[model samples]
Target: MKHVVFLSAISLLCTLLVSADTVTNPPHVVQFTIDPATTHQQIDNFSASDGWSMQFIGKWPQHKQEQMADWLFSTENNTKGQPKGIGLSLWRFNIGAGSSEQGDASQIGSVWTRSECFLSADGTYDWTKQAGQRHFMQLAKKRGVDQFLGFILSAPVHWTQNGLATNTGRGATFNLKAQHYHDFARFMADVVEGIERTEGIRFNYISPFNEPDGHWNWVGPKQEGTAATNAEIARTVRLTGQEFARRNIDTRILVTESFDYNCMYRTHPYVRADRGYQIQSFFTRDSSLTYIGDVPNVPRLMAAHSYWTNTPLTDLKKIRQEMGEVLRAHRVRFWQTEVCIMNNDTEIGGGGGFDRSMKTALYVARIMHHDLVYANASAWQWWRSVATGDYKDGLILATPDETLVDGQFTDSKLMWTIGNFSRFIRPGAMRIHVTGRNNDPESATNQEGLMVSAYRNTDNSIVVVVINYSTDEQKIRMNLHRPRITFQPYLTDDVKGNDLKPIRTVQSGSVTSIPPRSVITFVAAQ
Candidate 1:
């Protein structure tokens, strides 16, 4: 049967609705029909990057580092049954580009932003250089992180054309010297192989580029990055795949890592030639110079970031729709590999201040919903899992200072909001069909209130996440597979102190009221 809509005649009488703040007018009801039989992409994982922050934080006192890791990667539950941590399934380890080794002479102003490269200038490998990063990687494995990915923002300084990790004076040109392509590939493969041999952890996926499309100038005093054309990306990925094969490494190469979704679909007028339209450029048969679809160790997957593409709400969905169409046509899966609040997020007065408010959490939730549902992104990963700044970047925000060992570390509302999905929806879960939103199943969003998405685990359990963005309380009627199904709601709102606290249990066929300006996860087990 198709999805159906329902409204009770007594809905007007139930108008005395209680919101998160106070009693309000009777809230309107939205009937949500979740069909598990109809499903889409199988989620790979929900992940976050350690980036360069962990190179220092991981070196903190053993107890201090474990305290932070438990918050980000722990899956155990407390005595009250509330989750102990967000339980991230995947952890992205940064494969540095040697900026840190050069110190202040590297021209990268910030010492914290620079990453220590494993490949020394003498073409020798030092597996112990990134001690802080390796420390966290091992901790994640011990804590049950399911997958590990190694991502690089730039090639090592030794191989770059300008002998610098940042960018060359040549605008929009790839920083890597053409002669050192094979060397870079071999170095990355060596890092992967060395880590497996020494640390017993093999990267499941390796991304060769980060925003190769030149969406922004790679030349910055902030950190290391490189800009590459489609041809450059294709060549680098092919070489890396070959090197992986030569090393007998089982790691899959993640491609593109476009700066934004639009770069994956259309060539922006501002970008370099053959740099954008990555989905069609590298996958389609006719993209002569940049086609690496048949490369040896490459999977049929593409990844892109979610920066500068989210705004005005309506445009956000449309851009992702276009990106999804191309992905579907090519029969390639998509991954939203990276995201951080780098926009004019006017809702909370831009992305400048560190946000502990529910407003920022909902703002990010709406984007994640769009990516998973609209764009069919299999993996949703945040940029920095931990940070030492007052910016809206890190899920675990710390006091501002480069080498500050420990002052104050707090979990933002964004952390619990992510836990609503990352903790409940584990790897191998499938995104099932969710309909009955204003009778239009095409749009999975509610525009202003109650953006709901459903997923089904392999064990036949169901997870429904509802983001109530409206001020007024919203009511939802879930038409589930069986009658009298039990579900517990874990909420992340101001009233809940940004903690993912479990509320009272409710059964199917009963109307559940979700508090406004909050994210609620309804878990119905088998």
Candidate 2:
């Protein structure tokens, strides 16, 4: 089904008449006025990682590879000046540790999860390795991606205590040997320098550890992961900072990617005290542990993953509120650097099953709203941008083939749903306050039921994104502070492909209908 935009008055009248007849449930009247005076966080970027999937897909035929690149990174517009893809401002590059070349001995059974490393066991460097990841980096740069991030899941196998990319056991401990901290730091610095010199893409930020509080000691070939205590992470950062300074590298260090939002503020009884309450442990000046916030090149930002905390709407709101309060007190910013559907607790069941429907996409959008609105996150990013499993993880899915050539691929509504934000809300955009009421018949519903957020771009353009999770059409009455403004609505729904389709033009203080179970972005230039 093609999306019909009621551009003309006749078409609008006919669609309204049909909708009135078909929609028995009374339309929700949402009234919201943007308040630029009450501005919140400055949005840095909306990004995704080119991890396990990119290592292979980057090797795909030129045409297919170019298509994926354009879809993820293109900032170009049609002749009418509408965006083609979600203009992502940041690109995350995975810094591999040579597990892929080691085969089954690497412990990561899936070749896709294993990654190529530039450093060999003999302390030799091969800049030519990880050509696939480099290819994607170049593509992202060519498509106007300004920020590049290099995140690591594990250190080079040779430098690890267990001699494997993964942890030796399920214990929450650092896998990299203490004696080899300097070696690992130097390795990271060298890689950053080599890529910048050779490929002309300088990593603006480098995250050394991921999910440091999680247990990665599971057996078999699932994924390459490791755990580290907060103290260990601080030590690594301090060392890495020294290495970067010694080598005159300018990339900033990103700290402690927590496994969950709670870990950022609360210490789990099951985990070590030093491994949890990361924001306080790492950022606070008087903390018992070594504080790395004062370290050079360490930005005043705390990164955490938004997993398992997105449920029971109230709980989601409460967690983000608590996080925002704590971060604001410390004068530190928050970045939701990683998220995927890893649980089945809410209305949307999550599992390894691949879900290409709007259900998963809406679930993700709701979380994004909570993170941005409640948590005041500066940047939000998804996990793997591409996937090769039966999991509802990737924005784009590809065949399970290890070889990249001639493989089938598909894009999900989740990709376009993210585009509802990333396409318009570029970097430096400030989130403005928007308050509305979704008076559905169900009295138990909250703001999550019909989430709406607004942002002001650098060019003074306003982008309002609305996510309607209900079954009835929503009539939103946007009361802008500035009058006589025209809004162009771009919708992502079941009928339309993942690309954003421009719908009818709307005026300030006028009514616009958002189809049930759809995400719509209304753009108005100032």
Candidate 3:
């Protein structure tokens, strides 16, 4: 209630100083109009990555693991009206590259960052590998989670040029060798088929690379990642698509997971680097060296993370606006596949420290709004599902560091903040055109205050998420002309332990008081 109390004191102090003739300014009323006729991208899903953390937490005691999984995957709600979990529609399964098998020899610092491979050096496949990850996948399915995307961060270490999953230094080069591209592609297809046949979980989409842009140097000992030029990425994707076709794998291939948004539309950082201008490089008909859009089953889609877009908020708007324009011109669908707090050291202290306040939630929620409304992103996914550290990475914060054994796991405002969009907006839901009278949220000049976005689900229901970042509670009017009874509001903010908790329902066409520093998802189902 920092915002509420501070504003209250200011009002009181102003009252004492003002004369009797002092009249109060009217509340800033926001007019929202939803146009169903002009609809945008069909929201594919809201998802989080399992990374390497799940391998440890999935093996925890059944109840503990269930609790964690329930928070991430459960679609049901308690009798008290609190959602059991955020009900993420898609779960990103990380395809390991044998980093964990290398151990100390791998040169990757964090044991938690290492991942086990299903394919060994002898060219033999082990379906039993990544047991912990499989356990959570089963739990997610058991909890009614349907969609899954298998994402590979890096090629297997044995196939890499350096015989390591990642480089120790920065370089504008593909980690995997040219001759091994086909083998790596086959390996990816094999993993997709292997998981379905043995683990009983069929991957809906398979991503060949994670942040394969040249701008990002994946020499980090902190985690596992690789950088590849656009041409190499295209060649690998083509090979992977061919393998999928040959094996009759039903999963679609997702390619060129750019590290950041700049790389997607234009060349950034290195002018000579071919990683930039990914949409043109990979999807357009002009560039044959990197064009894979025509490949069988490869969708006309581009995926990029929302990293470094936090600072100067204007950059956030500009980058997305430009990206949206390019994406529209190319007619390519976009998905914000991965993002966590980064590059904002002075404002939010970067992603170093733990949750000191609800800043992380509010910040991320704004970016999510822009991604869906501005960039026309069909899918949005976080970097990690469960964070084992003090940083603002994971949705659920686990205790005892590694989360290896049974430990305490706490819900984060970031998780519920994403839920404000994810929980209500289901797959196949189309984002209807929304116009605000006082301000256009997509406008760069309008940064603060109530940032809003609305989506119409497949069942003809509407979900509107309102985010109030200002210190004062803002009043917003919904001009939805649909026949609705009451709109339910689930709030997540600095309200002391509020995790998508339901508040009093409101009548139709009411001006709602959105609390400051809070994210409220108003669901009005027909």
Candidate 4:
């Protein structure tokens, strides 16, 4: 009886072991591959702007400010040999128009949204007023940010028809007075020159308008903004370019930051007539509107915001495909200049909630992949680098109080997920072709819920970013085009916290397991 009972107990133990293995570690049937020889468009750079959020955050304690700077622009590794921050290649500086000084009279209700202009309403130029913004700019340069752009949402309050920083009570009409066009151009040019002289950082690009297609009429205390006809934009670009040349400024003019992708190619009935059909309106050689493509100091690229239209996977793919087709035919590149989780129709509902979870991170990753792969955007930029509100808009969030505590700021997974691309895929990296089965299909929506993109740096280093949106772990049988290449993986998941933790090196044809709901970047030498 003792022998029989011992034998039965051993059998039960074996069964329990098998059950545990089945529950915890399931088999992976997904296989993916990459072909380096197959190539795609070249990637320019990735960046985020220090907009309204930076105004106050820059005045925080020195240590807190430095920490935020290092996280965004530090290319060097930490003492533990991990990448310190995303190492952004470009930095955007918001060129305010004296709205903040107006206080409640600025018509912009939120003090955070109101920005101070170097040229005050009294026509006195104060170079020192925007000290906080300048400090961040200097920090970016110190940390090796290669590109700088200055963007304006509204002209000075004195120059507008309503004499207010917020829009005139008109829909889709140019809020900026037609008489002040040349003055505005001069103001912008002077700003470009002053920054270079004072801060030792030259503005490489100046975006004169932001979302000009949207109605900016004082719709219940929104940010300072204006709408302009494409003709007016072309006029501004011509004048701005002429002024830059006259002043010997090397900064190029970036035109027409369209509100959405569809706005670039099609006309919305509610939108201003001159604001829509942007690609053709500005770039086409034969259009009646003055062609700004050949204008001095104007780049051949067009920029648009990646908002609102990032949902219903099918629409995302179709609009991007159409936009890509138009751009390719015209030989003009696209830059997805700005994005944040705004519309509530996303996979994760968008809100002002300061969520630091992977859910928001994964949603952003999917949008980034779509922009790069489908739209063929040379550069991808986030809306705000830091935020003080409980909004999903910021990559990093801080407390609303003017003072900074020890742990007042929080870094979201969105920042690290973006880092997976920006930190590794440095500037001048060419996006190479990556074809595979299981999860690597080129569809807007994949059954496996995996999105993958590959890039090759100028030095021929390979970087592959894989996003697993599903709940099940995917076993990818990676078949590289080259032989004997070893890859190290850096993961941004709940377990690893966006650190580039290296697992065992795997050679070509080795099976790699991608954790569920994670973003993984694999780097390999040529």
- Lowest lDDT 10-residue stretch of candidate 2: 12-21
Q: Which tens-of-lDDT digit does each residue in 1-526 have in candidate 2?
A: 0122222232122101101112246764534444444467899999999878887788888788888888788878787656767878899999998888889988777777889899988898898888888888888898899899999998998878777887755466777877899998999899899888889989999999988787443331267778887788888899899888887888999977788788888876556676877888888889757689878789989899898788877878899989899898887888999988885544776657777888888888888988998899999999989878888789988884544545888888898889999989999988865543342212222454566677878876778787888777877665554346678888888875535888789876677787888889888776
Residue pairs whose backbone atoms clash in candidate 1: 15-26
Which candidate achieves the best lDDT against the true structure?
A: 1
Q: What's the number of clashes in each of the models?
A: 1, 1, 0, 2
Q: For model 1, what is the error of residue 369's alpha carbon versus the real structure, in angstroms, after optimal superposition?
A: 0.5
The C-alpha stretches of model 4 lying farther than 4 A from their native spots are: 1-33, 216-221, 402-407, 437-448
Clashing pairs in 4: 98-117, 352-390
Residue 171, model 1: lDDT of 65
Best by TM-score: 1
TM-score of 4: 0.91
Per-residue lDDT tens digits of candidate 1, residues 1-526? Answer: 1122222222111111111212246765545566665678888899898886888877777887787888888989889888888999999999999999889877888777899988888888888888988998899999999699999988999988878888746467678887989888888889888888888998999998888776564554357888888898888888888888876888999997888677888877778657878888899889888899988889889999888778878878899888888899888999998888875667667778778788888889999999999999899999999867768888998663445555557787888889998999989888877766454555447757667788877776778888888898777765443345678889899874547898888776667778778898888776
Stretches of candidate 3 off by over 4 Å are 1-26, 214-222, 270-272, 401-403, 438-445, 479-484
Q: Residues 217-263, candidate 3, lDDT per residue (tens digit)?
A: 55544467777778888888888888888988878888777777888
Clashing pairs in 3: none
Q: What is the lDDT of residue 173 in candidate 4?
A: 69
When sorted by lDDT, best at the front, the candidate numbers are 1, 2, 4, 3
Error of 3 at 190 (Å): 1.0
List the candidates' TM-scores in order.
0.93, 0.91, 0.91, 0.91
